[model samples]
Target: MWNKRRRHFESYPEIVIVHVSGYGRPESGGDPKKCKRGCYDIISQAYSGWCKLASTPEHEVYRLPLYAGNYVTALFGAMEMLVAYIHAQKTGEGQVVDVAQFEAIARIIEMYYTQCIITLEY
Candidate 1:
């Protein structure tokens, strides 16, 4: 069982387990770039695009206030934790919450496409 400190306790009565990660399980000496990009290529994965948006084209990278991808992923992580919390209240069973930034952003982009196809609203 993981905790807010980002460590797993791995025992019963696990109150809260939140895994907020940029990439899937950490590996030894992996490409720092690839870990950030992950398996999907979405706008949230576009570091260059994000930098361009923030008006800092000096390099392909810049420190933004929100860090959009991580921020959104963390929000999703909180939502997942909330759902798990509600379930725990009902069933008295705790579960781990694994949330990946790339996955969240990819899902968000996918949902946008889905909405565009279904309603052509945007």
Candidate 2:
């Protein structure tokens, strides 16, 4: 879904902006050992692909931050959205949607490109 959306936006340059949320989540389920392995595999694949595509001569794959504060990130995201909306209203253009965690996760997979391509599910 994300790739399709990206392509759509690329094709239609009139898409002035995009506001996305809930892109931070643990991408595995159940037992801790399996979850960790699964998460590692998923992240490794993503990083591998990113490394292949990156145009910069030098690249670094940084680890995700381990924050002690539980809701601080979410609060920051809300503040960002608020500021973006105000800016958009002042400028009189663009759109904003409160994307949920599940929706955001679903979009990250390459296979899910068809979801956005064939439906408005996102």
Clashes of each: 1, 1
lDDT of 2 by residue, 1-122 (tens): 56765676567533433333233323222234432342332343343342232223454543223421213334544665677667656775434334233233333444545554577343
Q: Which stretches in model 1 have alpha-carbon errors above 4 Å?
A: 1-14, 26-44, 47-65, 112-122
Show model 2 residue runs off by greater than 4 Å.
2-68, 95-122
lDDT of 1 at 108: 59
Enumerate residue pairs that collide in model 2: 1-112
Per-residue lDDT tens digits for candidate 1, residues 6-94, read 34333455466676666544432335665565433334466323333334446545434556677678779889999999987887777
Candidate 1, pairs of clashing residues: 1-10
Question: What TM-score does prediction 1 earn?
Answer: 0.53
Best by lDDT: 1
| Residue 55 in candidate 2, Cα distance off native in Å | 38
lDDT, residue 74, model 1: 74
TM-score, predicted candidate 2 vs. hidden true structure: 0.27
